[model samples]
Target: MGGTGGVALAGGGAWVGSTVAAQPAAAAAEAAIGGLTTPPAYAPSGRRPKYRRATWSQQFQTSHGWNAGGTGTASANANDTSVFVRGTQSVRVTTNGTGKQSYVRRTGMTAQNMTGKMIRLVFRVDDVANLSKLVFYMGSGSLANYFSWTFHAHSTTAANYVQSGEWVTVHLQWADVTSAAGTYSISAAGSPSTKTGFTDMSFAVYDNAGGPVTYRLQAVELVPDTATVFPKGVVSITFDDSHKSIHDLARPVMDSYGYSGTVYNIADAIGTGSFLTVGQMRSMQDFSGWEMAGHSYANATHTASYPKLTAEQADDDFRKLREWLVGNGFSSEHFAYPHGAFQKTSDGVPVDLIASRHFTTARSIISETIESFAPAMPYRLKALTGINDGSGIGGTALSKVTGAGGRLDRCVNSGDWLILCLHKVVEGTPATSTEIGKAGLTALMKAIDDRGIPVLTVEEAMASYT
Candidate 1:
């Protein structure tokens, strides 16, 4: 079996139940094969092997690979293709204009017990507003037992209503389809027919809002478990307060070590004093890469009674922020509560609105109090220690977040997601009263790089969890 959404559906499958801790791919394999609940396996101490064998890396560079079916028309889309990055041919699907305007796409495959294999599929949706929902499934040729999930390409429309498709490249990391889908309810335990086992792939889309939608399937292949299994101690170094110093000082330091960062901006504060200018934000993206999330619309800095914002007020705050972000070539998919404080009023406002509706994540001001270490369910509620001004007075030291070296060392060694939160990246002034000094920040970045772990922006790292 192969695998792996939000309403606005997770390109990543939905988190059905309890969120598990970060475990490596190998450990994930052992646990899935054995039982639903089991302790993690021995994590690797050093580097993972680079070599990989594709049980079958079917490069759909040409047509006529497998049988294509459905009410839609599947044709080789050399016109709209990813020739450079992903071979030549991309299969384009255009469904009929029915009420529940959708399509069916299935291709027969050789029968094999794909129980614990890490199944991977790749595709993209065009810039069409009518594109409502797309789902992929795996099952026996007869469509007896199957599993399905939704994916949205954050793309925009004619009126510039952007929806998860600035040309989204969906790399669905469906780990061990068995565990992902759940215990196979109906199975052919002893059957040996060619299509007896789950031996076919089906792709379908449901009721488009507008007319008909055309989505492109670049290619879909099954990856070895050793390839894309397990979670690592990923580092999402997020800097709050759109401080100018972040773009001026911090970016260079992080780039020097091949690292990137996320900024929780006060939409109303850009181009203002000591705040990030629009040009600098774009430059960081061009120079290296960056992520921008909502901090607050106007009130990035907290007032005296910070923790007590009403739910309606909080919604209004985030809404303004989202508007600014969307209007500025960005999607308001992430948010960081101002003052690093999480607020959920009993009337069901503020944090609740941010959590359920507004943002995908609500990062924590306090690192230790955070549930687990990294990539937890209320993932929006991440734990972060400071690197610069995040002194032990309030949040954990930058050193603590970096495991102070050994602990940081072991954190990566054992494969946990470590998110280091910082404010400013300053130089001379020991403004221990505020931001992190350049020296300490430099050292922390170095230690993190030495571990050979991937440094991702907050949005990028979230993909690993599901």
Candidate 2:
């Protein structure tokens, strides 16, 4: 990599690479997740901006890729740093006593989309007494377009603080980018320093310790906050039909454990006498664990499966439901098929193409458990079995939902999404065929939560991958 003072400004088109291939959890997975897991509670962490790595070592680059620049002397900080996690080398820099004026930078990172994402830069100062401030950036335009600023905990007061000594991981969350592409302020830390709304095209590490200090850029990695953000495999628990059992029985249990589930609501059923009322639907947000997505504007009246709905009907129903939910303050563009079925239009078209046009994902359970490598196929996401497959009766064992010892654990080990599908959560007994009792549902969610995998709404699960 060569350091040429400034970058060659490219058009906004490079951002496409950084755009996440957002597939719906089981819509691709809904069809598949018939399952999703319950996420674990975040450990204690405050002040530090918490986040999870959307990516890590696989994308972590070497400091050798960086270019030398500034009054400071920059080189492969190889002598001082150690190779960790995927054979990557670190950069070492010796500052020239001038803060911010000295920096080692690397340009051309079109995939570093910092929009709703966070990037972590981990490093250590050989001498904490001498070096104090650190800055990591992403932007090819100019210093103003940078993303990360200060990693020191002393204050957001942008630099002149001491957080040195051991290996420190600094995280930067991108708020809104400045309207003027090239405008940014290397302002104080505590004060908001927002800029760079575009895709990251370059990265740079600056020494603002205020003097000549040598520091090792051990790793510039993306780390997720164990709190709020998830670390590994994903899960989603989907409750179809806005069933009263979901709000009454499931909600309390999920909330008590700090977990959440997705509820696919049928628009026409809102405010009905027996189903979730409009007030109840709106109030579901209070639990903060349930995601209300679209089931169908009007509940399925006939034996029509996905293909039964014409393109126009699918579009209208899905679109209207999403709009209605959003208008009612629900966050969703996800959907669920009335029957656990996926199909193609009459002329050999995957009916789910219509979902891609209107919803994020549409759900169906093509198989008992999803293929680990196949979660990305948004429209055909496979589902796991709640009751033993091939049996239509309720007397079957609820092994999938309850995990049956290590069943859910095996899925997590293989990195598969165990999208658990269930109908109602009853008290003493399951009210219907596919419904799980309260204790069974709680135990199922608990088992998944114990595994430490993230439980995402179907849509949230897809975003986690993309």
Candidate 3:
């Protein structure tokens, strides 16, 4: 589960073998999260730049089997220096019979302490005989962890992680290695850097087999902690089919706690007794943090009659509903396919323009946790239905609120959105209502407030993704 033995070089260039103990945990765990009182502010430094400037490069020589290649470069800072070596001009060696090695240089760097700062390294590989044992060395001549994907491979092996003939970006965060906080971890991006120490950085090309192999070096960069960007967690809630009970029973509880929710409105079903009327939807849209999104013009069942509806029919229905919402003073940027039914064109493109104009994010029954997928993926919201009846809302709602099975508790801990979809909040009867009465709803709201997770409407959540 851990890396093979390696070495670490202290600030004065003293080397230590891989027997060093792990550092203590950082203080971040003890710090309190202030609160989710407001949307996080965007500091100018957090923004990603449109284009990056090359800083350094190192190309590998073919002595170990690789052909000669040139290394290019880029960086976000001008004062930050790095090194470069290309295959055509440098020495190459072979590790065993299979891997290749190359010569590297350190230029434009000054020795300085980099104790708390975050450092990043990127490498580019044109080709590789095998990628099993790639490693990196700092200015102190200590080898960092081998560049393998054993821990992050999901289900694959580390040896199979190489992408030959294409640029691969690897990022290495020094903060995680140096601190107890686990704040830093190494990752790769497109190219390798030539920077060294704290003042200037440099990069070198080497093969796992200690022999030479040919490959191109694009660029390398050493970005400070302030220059790195991290994404904020996203939370989204959706209510299927604007059921009147959502407004009559759920609305009051949500509004009282200032919780926001998205109501998926079925155009033709609006006036039905069990469903919300068009007028009710328009009013909900006017409320703060509440949003009205399309579920379909008539709850079209794509699984049954998908091919029957022409492209124009589907487009027209979507367009009309969007126009109705916008003309009635609602945000027109969200929509959910009715019953999660959708169509794909002959070329695999969605027939409806919902994917084009308005819908920024779409939700499917993907997973229970938002962390399960990439943050950029459309959030997968889970429905808390009768599956957990024995222990879910069926148990004491207060116990459920503070316990593991509680929806709100899971959402807060995982930083994923909790979207509660309720049908008929019955006046009586445990079977129909799960017996989660108004008191239960109140208790749930209090738990959410105490946990410090902001409750925003679906529109608010979608805005963050777009």
Candidate 4:
């Protein structure tokens, strides 16, 4: 009555559509004789040896060209034994002006079962123009019918692969595959770097004759049913002044990739000519994951009012700004000192009266990691510069926290909040850059996420402290 392997017996008359006839006498006797055996014993609840789930993943490194037998031809290379399992057919490669081919088969060796799996491919290239292609085949097809993922600019023009050259890593993820067609995703980076979002993707490689082609190839890894969680950590990216570019250009990009930042608004600066409007500030406050804090009224000149104003005068200024913020539907809990300057008494209590009442916490400019500074008051930490600048944290900047035991590393080790203060997000600005951009900030956030710290806005972080 069931499909496929259904059992049927001879009927006395014509057989009915849904019914099965009785078994013969000899068949019934054999079944009854085999029913008295004991079942096998098996362990129920004991621990088995733990093996890495990643062992089934595959990795390949190729230096020599795909040419086999020292004869330059596009044919199967027996000596060159680089193989890919399913969804991959022939390896059509061109290296140093010469073309060659190799075949991937599951013979004698164990082939990786990557059905419905997440995989990553990292490719390292020597030059940018040297083209390398990886052909993927789903059904029984020749190189003309398969999809070719190619990488263009490569450094080497010879048979031997160069090590210290520009390389790219390609990531491929496979989903469902059917008789009709299969689905997959791919991403490529200049080096062996992992990214959250991918672009330049051509899905469903339907061309059949070398479908979608990418440039370079380094290494490929398969992550089978594994969950990659971003580590938890606290990273504070603060931008002083109502810099709309930080919000308009940087914020969207940050949010697009799941990151949050704090924008410190100088109360008097908003709605002024070159600054963000009050409406923009309010919009940022209502932004799903962003926070707006105070950057002081008019970014008060340090040379004029500071180091001279009595505690009372400072308190009045603070109260005026704090009341304005609250009236404007903004939180007055977090404040950043103008010019990174704050008046302090002999005992180190901030002399500004508003420091005691209006603000929950304050921050100042103290670049690099200094263990002696207190985290509770006037949180002194490095401020990020614009991207590519030698001053911003991350990247090739030695002044920033790119090296070992840098500011970010120290902050992680101490489990302290690392607040990065910035004046502007525009280029050609002091303590900032024009071309160097928020990508550095993104990198820093990723680093913090990697180190297992929780990133919170100024207001959110202040709430925890309180």
Q: Write candidate 2's Cα lDDT for 1-466 as tens digits.
A: 1111011101000000011113332233222211222211221111111123345432234334555466554444433323222234455666665455445565554444332334545454555444534545555454455545443323232211123332333344332111222454432211224423333433333445555666555445543322223333467788777777677888888888787788878877777765787767666765574678777776662145556665455555656666777778876656677675544444323455455555656676544224222232344455544442223555436663344323354444324455666667778666556777787777766777777777777766655534
lDDT per residue as tens, model 1, 1-466: 1111111112221111011112343443323222212211221121212323346555445543544445544333433343212444555666554525243344466765543243444444444556655666666645555655454322232111112222232322222122124333422221112212656566566435456566555455554442233243466788887899888788889888888888888877798878998788877766677887778777533442124655555555656677777767664367776655553343422242233345666676533222222222342354454445344444445554455333355345334445667777777644453578887788788877876767888776654443
Return the lDDT, model 2, position 173.
34
lDDT of 2 at 307: 61
Candidate 1, residue 101: lDDT: 25
What is the TM-score ranking, best to worst? 1, 2, 3, 4
TM-scores for every predicted model: 0.48, 0.48, 0.46, 0.43
For candidate 3, lDDT tens digit of each residue in 1-466? 0121111111101111122212221211111111112211211111212222223323332322222222311112111112112222323222232333332334334454433222233333434553333333344322231211111111122112223322233333331121111222332311112223432233434444433344333333432331122111233445666778767876788788777678767777778868888777776667645788766665653233222455445555655666666666666455555434333332222322222333444444322222211121231223333211223345223454345534444444323344444334444333543334555555556766776767666556434433
lDDT of 4 at 456: 66
Question: Cα lDDT of model 4 overall?
Answer: 0.40
Question: What is the per-residue lDDT of model 4 for residues 1-466, given as tens digits with 9 covering 90 to 100?
Answer: 1121112111000111112113443443223222212221211111211212343333332332232221222333322223221122213322323433322322122234443233343332223243333333322221212223331112233211112221222223221111122223222211111222221111111111232222223233444321122112246767776766776666765676566677767777777777787787777667747777666664553334333455445555566666767778865366666655553322322332234345555565533222111131232223433334436444335234534555555444433345665544433323534333556545655665666666667666544423
Q: Which stretches of model 4 miss by more than 4 angstroms? A: 1-233, 299-305, 344-353, 367-374, 378-399, 427-436, 449-452
Q: lDDT of each structure? A: 0.50, 0.50, 0.39, 0.40
Q: Which stretches of candidate 1 lie over 4 Å from their true place?
A: 1-232, 304-307, 346-350, 369-374, 389-395, 402-407
Residue-pair clashes per candidate: 28, 40, 68, 39
Candidate 2: count of backbone clashes, pairs at least 3 residues apart or interchain:
40
